[model samples]
Target: MDCRRLGEAGPVVSRVAFGNSLTAGNQLADDSAVACVRAALEAGITTFDTADVYSDGRAEEVLGAALSTVPRDRVVICTKVGRGAGGGAGGLAPERIRSCLDASLKRLGTDYLDLYQAHLYDDATPLEETMRGFAEAVAAGKVRAVGVSEWAADELAEGARLAREMGVPLVSNQPQYNMLWRVIEREVIPACEPLGIGQVVWSPLAGGVLSGKYRPGAALPEGSRAVAAKGGDNSLRRWKFLQDDTLERVQRLRPLAAEAGLTLPQLALAWTLHHPTVTSAVIGASSPAQIAGNLKALDVALEPDLLVAVDEVLADSVVRDPDLTLSRMLRRPRQA
Candidate 1:
């Protein structure tokens, strides 16, 4: 229920931004989708995160239709571009950006977006061409601020510089950051910290791996993302969390959450937000009450001792070890 500033007074956005990346309604009925959005809004979640590619924009339609119920000014509307209608070549082509925004506006049923982000970096596209499109959006007052998702620190820095050179505003960046996934801690945080760019993190729960569901010698839950996402190259990486005692560390946190009077999910969310660089934690949900469970993390600060305990539990754990997945160990830093 608590809110935070989006960049410099853009809007007071919810600490826990409701997300529809998965709620894009591949199967949900239109009426059920409405209930989901209504439930999120009623639960005091004012900020919504969606993408153009999600369900081929059906997600945006549902998200927009839901937000329409509330006074527009009361909600923080965030949607992304660059990822286009089709999966191929979803970059920030200048004309493509314009068309993308115009279509999103129509789908969202809004004149402007509170926070419009680039879905991902287009290495093939010229940086200026892309950022300039965002600049155009800002100039036209169709978007309040421009942000990027899943971009590396260098990419963000370049984008910020381009925004400045072009006299545009780049306010936020979304990256996959969590205690377990601290890849950004190495360079991304340092890059954005002094530049006035904020971080909105995805997978703060490691795709629900940190939700405290798995146990030692346990089967992946029947209907959870862990079991259902076993197709070729699914990002869920079925049972991947058990690669090196991840679930063990997560289970350890249960008693730690008990001590803190919080649920494991709450503890997971709080730990991500505990970092100063994070501006908001995006919580994607299937039903409405998922937002409520996530919102319990509001203001639930993790104490240092518990954090130390977590670190100690993970001290012996190994991920990205060169010995495992050794083929491309030369490509990136080895997990120690």
Candidate 2:
């Protein structure tokens, strides 16, 4: 497995991390979840991402079992707090953060988490308290490093200040970043750049919308997130990225992936890693083969002109603008 550093003096994990969302079971049979983990380990995907809020904690349970198949030190385990594994944003009180990390450790059946991330930015929870809680976890040897997710520039900066004050190392920021969701580049990416914080972008596949299965007007495929009853409302903030223009771009990229001997998903993931700001790209797979396909995307660089060609397709479309309007698009923190 190819390893990437989560900033300086922090954990180095597999570039292709195993990501499990609430619906991992949708893609894998009950037995395959564990099987996928084992397969990922054998395939050298040493970084594993799970969250307390995924499937009300069932995802974590499944992930823990899979990691248990391998010795602990050989693999890097990453899980998140702040959002209840049940899927609601939980206030990050000191006690809540501590309790959540402890519970995640217990559920994952590990003594310490290699990377413990805040699932979301809990505005209601003071940034100081949350950073201190994660720092304390590191100090207590219960966590190897601290990280955050879905945070904007200021929020990431705040965490950095607090981590420095508390003498804790804040290592990374994981966000939803893909060719289709480049919004982080405008806000989140610039913030973390100077700090030397690694960026592990989740949803590099845009919730599977970038996998070339969806079309302009075709019926949704089986197991696609868009087909889920609740997928639309939860992801409405990102609906534009899945529009006709995005699909057209994905179609155009078929030749690119074919040229690289990869699939559309591989092409998309490779395109994401081309960014200098990204440290690693988190990939969620329902099956072992999906993870296997994604692993090959590492180091796949999209040339500048090909990237420009992809953007030309997006220029006129109403699809996602990648800026989330925070820096280039409209802001919606109030909606959350």
Candidate 3:
């Protein structure tokens, strides 16, 4: 796999990061999850991204155990804070930031994180407070670099300003971007590129809609994410990409993928990475074979004409509203 600098100041990481939410959570069996992580390592994916809120911290536990066999320095471990873990207060409060980083480190079996990100923009806390907390983490040697996820352009600008003043490198942003999801392109990319903040995009496949497994008129395929959602796995339903129109548009891209000698999923991933500001596209796999297939995207580059054809096929269906960048604060009863 090809490697790239995570941002202006972060470590060099695999262009395709192995996301742990799917396999490490309850969605997959424990052995399968561990195997999938090993499979990613075998495929040369050196970057792993996870969040503390995922499966109420089980995701990080699984990832930690999976990485025990590999030397820590060989991989970049990127985890997130700011979403409440195990019933604690949520948000980017200074105390919460420091406490969360400590907990994440213990769960990940590491002394320090390559990158620790704010899972979402915490509007309730002062941006200065959050940046200061991150700076403190860096000072304490608990976190190497800092980043954020799903932050608006204005919020990012403010955070970047604070990080600069604190002498901390606000290196990366984790946003949802894919062939069908272009919301980040409307403003976030513009704001981030100038600040030297690279994007490590999530949902690069639109939650498997771009994989061509879900057809426009066909029934939900057995064992697919849509099926999982129907069985009450609501996480995969966030994208809303399985709609008839979107599926039809995705189906039309088959020929484009064929022309490029790639699968539809690879085409989508390659397109996301084609942008100059995207440092990595996070891919979650339920099995080792999936990782092998996704790794192929590192070699598939979409020509200019193919990129235009993608836009033409997805015309009017692409999600580009800048306002979608704001994440809603979720309130849940504290865990026992």
Candidate 4:
């Protein structure tokens, strides 16, 4: 696997990060999750990303166990805090940051995290306090670098400023980036490029919608993210790609994938990594084969003409409004 630096100052990590957000709950069994992590390690993906709120910390335990046998220095472990489960308290309050960091370290069975991120921008807490909390973690050797998730361009810039003042490197920003979700392109990319903060993107396949398995008019596949969202009010809004119009556009990309000699999912991943600002694309898998298949995306080269064609094909379905990032962040309550 090819490696890339998180930013001008952060640690170098694999281009593809193995995401463990789905390790627990009904998504994946403990043993299966361990096997998938092993598969990723064997395939040369050295970066593993998890969060404290995922499955209420069970995901971190599973990931820590999976990497226990591997040498500590051989892999980069990344995780996040600030978000709470079950609508409980959640924010980047200093005390919460410290407490969550300690909890994550215990759960991961590690002394320090390579990258520790605020799961979201906390409107409730002062950014300076959050930066100080992260700086304290760095000073005490509990975290290597700090980052944020789903932060708007302005929020990120201010955090970067505060992080610099605290002498802590704000190295990464985790966001949802994919063929259908291009919200980051208009502003986030431009803002982070100058700050030396790299993007670690999630949902590169748009929650599996870009995998070409969800046909325009066919029944949703069992266990798919789409299927799981069947009755939620946010299902349609969250998964606009499930609509026939969008799925038809997605289907049109199959020929493009074939031209590149790649699977649809592989094509989707390659598209995200094509951008210069992207440091890594976090991929989650329920099986070993899924891990292996996604790793192949690194080998596929997207031509300029092919990319242009892709934009033309999905132009109507793509979400480009930059405000969506901030609006989504605002929708979540801030506490803790």
Rank list by lDDT: 4, 3, 1, 2
Residue pair clashes in candidate 1: none
Which 10 consecutive positions of candidate 4 have the poorest summed lDDT?
A: 228-237
TM-score of model number 4: 0.93
**What is the lDDT of every predicted structure here?**
0.75, 0.74, 0.85, 0.85
Candidate 4 residues lying further than 4 Å off, grouped into runs, are 85-90, 228-239, 326-336
Question: What would the TM-scores of all predictions be?
Answer: 0.87, 0.89, 0.93, 0.93
Pairs that clash in candidate 4: 90-335
The number of clashing residue pairs in each candidate reads: 0, 6, 0, 1
lDDT of 1 at 7: 60
Give the worst 10-residue stretch by lDDT in candidate 2: 325-334
Q: What residue pairs are clashing in model 3?
A: none
Q: Write the per-residue lDDT of candidate 1 for residues 67-158, one digit (tens) a residue.
A: 78689988889999875433345368788899999999999999999989988777557888998888899899999988887677677789
Better of 1 and 3 by TM-score: 3
Candidate 4 residues 177-211, lDDT tens each? 99999999999999999999999998898778889
The parts of candidate 1 lying over 4 Å away from their true place are: 27-29, 84-90, 227-233, 242-244, 316-336
Q: Give a tens-digit lDDT track for model 3, residues 1-336.
A: 789997789989899998876557666877988999999999999999999987778899999999998998999999998765432444788898888888889999999999999988776777788899999999998889999998888889999999999999889999989878788887889999889899999989888888999888888887776664322235444556767898899999999999899999889888888988899999988779998987788887678999999999999888888776745323333369
The full ranking of all candidates by TM-score, starting with the best, is 4, 3, 2, 1
Q: CA shift at 92, candidate 4, in angstroms? A: 0.8
lDDT of 3: 0.85
